[model samples]
Target chain A: MSTDHLDGNAAAGALREIFTTDLTAATGTCASCGNVATVAQAVLYTNAPGLVGRCPGCEAVLFRLVRGPGRAWLDLRGVTCLEFALPDPS
Target chain B: MATVSRGFFGRRRSGDPDLPPGQYLVTDFPVLSAGPTPRLRTEDWEFTITTETGEKHAWDWAALMALPAQTPTVDLHCVTKWSKLGTSWRGVSLDTLFEDVESAAEYALVHSYGGYTTNLPLQDLLDGQAWIAYEFEGEPLEPEHGGPARLLVPHLYLWKSAKWVRGIQLLHDDEPGFWETAGYHNYGDPWREQRYWGD
Candidate 1:
């Protein structure tokens, strides 16, 4: 559903920047690898607001990585580390 | 009025206690399994139909369309519980696609982007209902929806409905795809209620 269409290359670049910093701060593991599981890439799209980056280790892609309307909710798809960061932990 | 047959995510049923609803929809278009229109123009788009005898019949998109078109109304059930009914689609019947291919007795493999793949008995692929769709709802299919073309098998779960489909490869055995190997049902039969892991 990602209609916030940044140029594909640009989106990819933005994801790279987000992965390097924000993700590492939030989760120590790589987004792609799930091994080191550290943040490797991140991109914020107007459409897929909470969407995150792919896994750094395996290059496995995870669509719509973020959770929340204005960045408050976190639907981590049951991801443990991510859920812990939520203000209203379920 | 013809209504699409559908069910909800969860519903109360007498005697059965509870039956999970599975939703889906059908299209009234030529749902062809299309390959990527390479970013480059003038690039050759090649496809092949393999047979049990190990024979391969190859063709370009133009040549393939020239063969014939048959329309079938089918019930498309996605793994996500979305079902569409009486969707009309026109395409070369799998039987006709295999005409002269000489391997009707073998299995068929469908390959696509994102490492998605699935297998069907040659019998299933040859079903007159199967198609390599080119249009959806009377319009040229869009890219985000796997436009230009896509494979539409109304009989199976929609994930088996590989987007950005390319070619048909005849195989002697079944092979699980990215989803299937990751625990999706191999056959993906919706009516049989096959969907995710252990189904």
Candidate 2:
């Protein structure tokens, strides 16, 4: 399907609910294919049963979000590691 | 608690008798992918079946077309809670492909052209349950829908049906595939609402 929706930036709002930093600017490595890319570069599918973020290089699903009435489930098993930039003190 | 979006819920269609629990009906076939769609020529396409012992069975496009095909109308449920009913597809059955091979493996990992994988019990793929579908709605499947060929395991959540499927790896031990290892349910049965780990 055509990726008409925005990239992983579409996930920034949901992710901000759990993380203090802006995840859209974070970098991640795909555990399955070893491809590294910024979270914003990954593909996002918001129409499915949940919000699914997939790696841009290998298409491996990097994370999934399922928000319930009072709880949210975030799955990040597809990412081997994530590097978040430190805020500049200057 | 985090706020939920109402957009996540599609409108329910009346008179729909086959949808699973916690799903809404969608008229459009939404495209969901992790990466750019791989453009592959049918001439170069091949489907392989590798047994646990390393024996290999391969079929190119022509060889695959030589086999009998069946068109089945089935309902699809996505783990994300969208249901598309009566989708039609034409392809050879896994039973037809596995008829010649003899293996004792209880689990199988479906590999896709784009390095995606999903695991399932070997039994879930046999006995007229699944197909390597290449045609959707009487047209050659589109790459976005896993053209060339995609695994169709309608009974499970759609993720279990790996798109752009390339091969099947039979294994004695159950291995977590891309989604399974990533916290999606190992056996994604929509009826049971098995969308993630511990679901």
Candidate 3:
């Protein structure tokens, strides 16, 4: 049997380099299947050429982060929209 | 070139001939799926091959199990830069499954139970190249590893091996699948390092 690797939450460390806020908790809708789920639920394949986040509902790639030589490429075509929850000021 | 972290050593095995370019050797088989692992029973399982002309070939679990099974030990190379060597699997060859099916289709779109699809050339799947594997490492395949049956094309990137494979749709024209449309190479050959589009 294959080992179960980490989910989208594991990509948070790499994603922090790009986004200002944490993306794991953000809710997004899949453009392919229209299923809404938190980014944490997205399947993540990391340590590759880049970080790949796929929708849990439809299995469509939701986002990709590729770091090149002094450059970064971000593709979010598979996501229809992302809704972020603002932090509560306590 | 991207700068490497100080004292950073990749997980590459020393002098492993089976390891491909830009890939590190790993002993553990990693499970990479797009969604929840599908649990399917053998009694409810069926394999189908459909051609562009609407011709179809079907096989139940028992019929498939009764076929001549071959256990081949092969290396698996994932587009994710991980190559696992000497992995053993048992399955009926695609050649046997496609024995009597007559079609001039140049391409094939493999469909899975989870609605996942991957495309490949017809030639890539023939001539003792691929299989519908249901047993791995002398054990019944697990759902996370594409249990019941999954297409095992060890030559290409592992993503091309669609898990929970249910049917195959032969096409005269090439059609990009999930990852192919998203940005992956249409034909993911690890030997050539064709990981993304225009590689």
Candidate 4:
């Protein structure tokens, strides 16, 4: 199976779609402390590998996917979208 | 995504402070920013600032350049672990940018392309040390390095020193950006080594 079908842009777009859709919708029991929380930021960078999310109540970094299979995927992931506020200086 | 033994905010093998002293150079530009003086093909370039209250100001290149410029020599520590020191950038200070605005927000979210973003304390944004740099190495900044204009907070990790920065939006609450939302330290305090996913 030729993987040439994935352009960096296309793959990035797909990831972005995931973030806006499934990733954003994901909420589960926190692996640490067994508290329910939401994913804050899904890290896609290799050096700082992991799926980082925050506890809704304690704000602790509960679920960490550091240094594992996901670590490898983060290396190849490209930034798809950046959400920020557009404040008016006036 | 190669993992370097050296982390952006981990203990150095030499045990030197994580922060760069004052004369190091981090040149991952060209391929990273833009290669050279990206020609402004048209009179369409604009730099704007937004407030947490949802106010915005747009400035053309000339208008932005018209703002007072200051030369600040600061140490830049990148999230990738390399620190460039003694770099002097001259541009408009954020205090000057938000001078006339009477917004009461306490924080600002810096926005940029390349899927990068970071948050800045309102005080830090107003810090005279912070500037929207247009020139580097005594020349116009290269686009790859946030040419024309880029936010340079010498005190914070270079990631917080956002590249290709187009605007700063004042915020009432602390909202994380692309990297911060992921696992990168929210504040990116170099002194605290708030560098990666968790502290």
DockQ of every predicted complex: 0.04, 0.16, 0.10, 0.07
Candidate 1 ranges beyond 4 A from true positions: A1-90, B1-21, B24-44, B51-54
Candidate 3 stretches with Cα past 4 Å from truth are A1-90, B1-11
Off by over 4 Å in 4: A1-90, B2-42, B113-115
User: Best DockQ goes to which candidate?
Assistant: 2
Q: Give the residue spans of candidate 2 off by over 4 A.
A: A1-18, A27-90, B1-15
* Sort by DockQ, top down from the best: 2, 3, 4, 1
Model 1: docking quality category: incorrect
User: Candidate 4 at residue B77, lDDT?
Assistant: 72
lDDT of each: 0.53, 0.84, 0.85, 0.61
The true-versus-predicted C-alpha distance at residue A88 of model 1, in Å, is: 30
User: Candidate 3's residue-wise lDDT over A1-90, tens digit each?
Assistant: 556887788998656744777778889999999999998998886643467788777677788776544555677888888888765545
For residue B68, what is the lDDT in candidate 3? 99
Q: Which residue pairs clash in candidate 3?
A: none
Q: Is candidate 1 or candidate 3 better by TM-score?
A: 3
Error of 2 at A33 (Å): 9.3
lDDT, candidate 4, B30-129, per-residue tens: 1232112244421556667887677888777788878888888776776555665567788888888878777888888887644346787878877585
